[model samples]
Target: MSDTKDSDSDSGTGRCAGCMESTSEKFRGFLNFLWNPEEKTVLGRGGKSWGRILIFYLFYYAFLAALFAVSITIVLGTLDPNEPRFQTRLQAPGLSIQPKLDASIKRTSDVIFTAGQADTYTQYTNTLTEFLKPYKENQATLNNCTNGKVKINQQYSMEKPPPSCRFDLADLGPCRNEPYGYDVGRPCIFVKVNRIIKWYPVGFTDLSKAVGNADSNAPPLKDVLMARNRAYDPNRMYVSCYDVTSGNQTYLNTAAGVSANTMYYPEDNGIPFKYFPYYGAFLQKDYMTPLVAVQFNKVTRNVDVRVRCKAYALNIQDNERMRIGYFTFTLRVNE
Candidate 1:
């Protein structure tokens, strides 16, 4: 009896052990990652690492894209500042530049009067008087120093300059017709005439000097800028362009549409230009050089700029006074 009871107890213990082993095996399947030595300690393939890699690639691609964008923007800016297309030519009247500049080469000596030369004195004096001899007594009104009649913006170029006096009188009247050749009217009529003649409301006084010059000996076709002057006021500033080169006067045919004797030349590279060639009459608004078939798109880029034109004096040059020369000035767009 004792032996049989012992055997039964042993069998019960074995069954209990088997049940515990089966339960451990099932739990091991659920927690299998806990004992994997290589996976637990290795340094890679985590979610954080993948996020960082993705972010690095995004920034790297963005930087390259920005660099390329800047490079393209710089290269694409080579378009002409002055559009030279024929259809768009008549858009801006001020931009309507002709082939060559036109203005009479006048000398200051032609207007100055000498005491001994009565004929010459009378001729200029008559011209002076004719300019001043207005039919009306309102001469002082036009002088800005006095009554200041016309507004500043109202001024424009006409075929003829504004009248010095009313009713185009032929003569200043001999007055004393005196041997001294002194001017008539009140005190300093000649001085006022001289002032008006020198005060050009339409022409440029100075020329520009540019930067990054391609050549040091050539005057390139550039957008002419206003040079410098002491008496120039920003609000009431006037402009004018003078011939820098002392070349012979060129007479262009506006009718036939070509220029001769002028220094401006077109590029032979057959590069299609965007600007039209324009020319005006010597002293008038006449189309001496009509909107020509030339171009100015590649003017500044191709041409080398070296020379900045100096202010040409149009009066006598004795005793350091430079006033006896012809400076036909016309203002072109600076900007």
Candidate 2:
């Protein structure tokens, strides 16, 4: 009876231990099969399974690549190369002031200059040259354009061949001189109206009378005194410049000494009406914005003069942020 009891206890203990070891072996075998691809059997599958997986991933990646290419093609088809598709938010384009930088300053919205600084003045003048590069006139492009106004009434005409008004850069006159009037403390401020399709100025009629009626506190529009000689156009836009700081009595006395004169290129008052209804780049590839150069003649050395230029139009609107129809900059000719 004792021998039988001892035998039974040994058997019970040994069986439990043996079962545990078997389970551990099975688990280790499963891990080796998953971890080692070099092993004959893997994930309970034949060698063909490995080849199948590689083929599956190759097809999957190729399909994803093809889908991406198609998506890009669709997006490009919707875009217009010449004009923006959506312009409702920016109904009126802003006025651009050029030469608004120096060599040290890569880009800026305001201008800073020093009298007798030829290097700084030259740098600014070069910028103007580059800006006008697109508008570089040649015989081929000017075939349809003439000295007078050219208008396009049909979309098909724009498609067939559009017309552009001749804007001879020579009209810049004294402002376009070497050093650009910087040597004599007279810096040229180039103003351009941003391009917007089918937009026309409303308050351009009798610009001389309108300029004459400028704010009494501001300096007189002495430039308009010569308007009597030139033929004024009702369809063109008008520009006005004033000393915004003239409101202060102390500043006004000092500001009066600086002669600020407005000189419009191609014509006086504003950009010509002939350059209107800007078609897309496809129609007018060499199109450029109508520009006005205001020469601040006799700016006092070492004085900080703040000036503002505004475009007047009955239909055109103005914004407080200087984003549309207006811009302000400081002109300091420090020696």
Question: 1-335 in candidate 1: lDDT tens per residue?
Answer: 99999999999999999999999998875565444455542234455766888999999999999999999888667643223224332221221111121233243321232224454345444444443334224433432222212223333244443323221111222221232123221111111111221122222233242211221122211221211212322122111222222221111111111122111111111101111122122222221111111111111111122211112122211121222111222211111
lDDT of 2 at 142: 53
Following a full C-alpha superposition, what root-mean-square deviation does model 2 have from the true structure? 8.0
Best by TM-score: 2
What TM value does model 1 have?
0.20
Q: Estimate each model's TM-score.
A: 0.20, 0.70
Output the lDDT of residue 17, model 2. 97
RMSD of 1: 27.6
> Considering only N, C-alpha and C atoms within 3 Å, which residue pairs clash in candidate 2?
203-314
TM-score of 2: 0.70
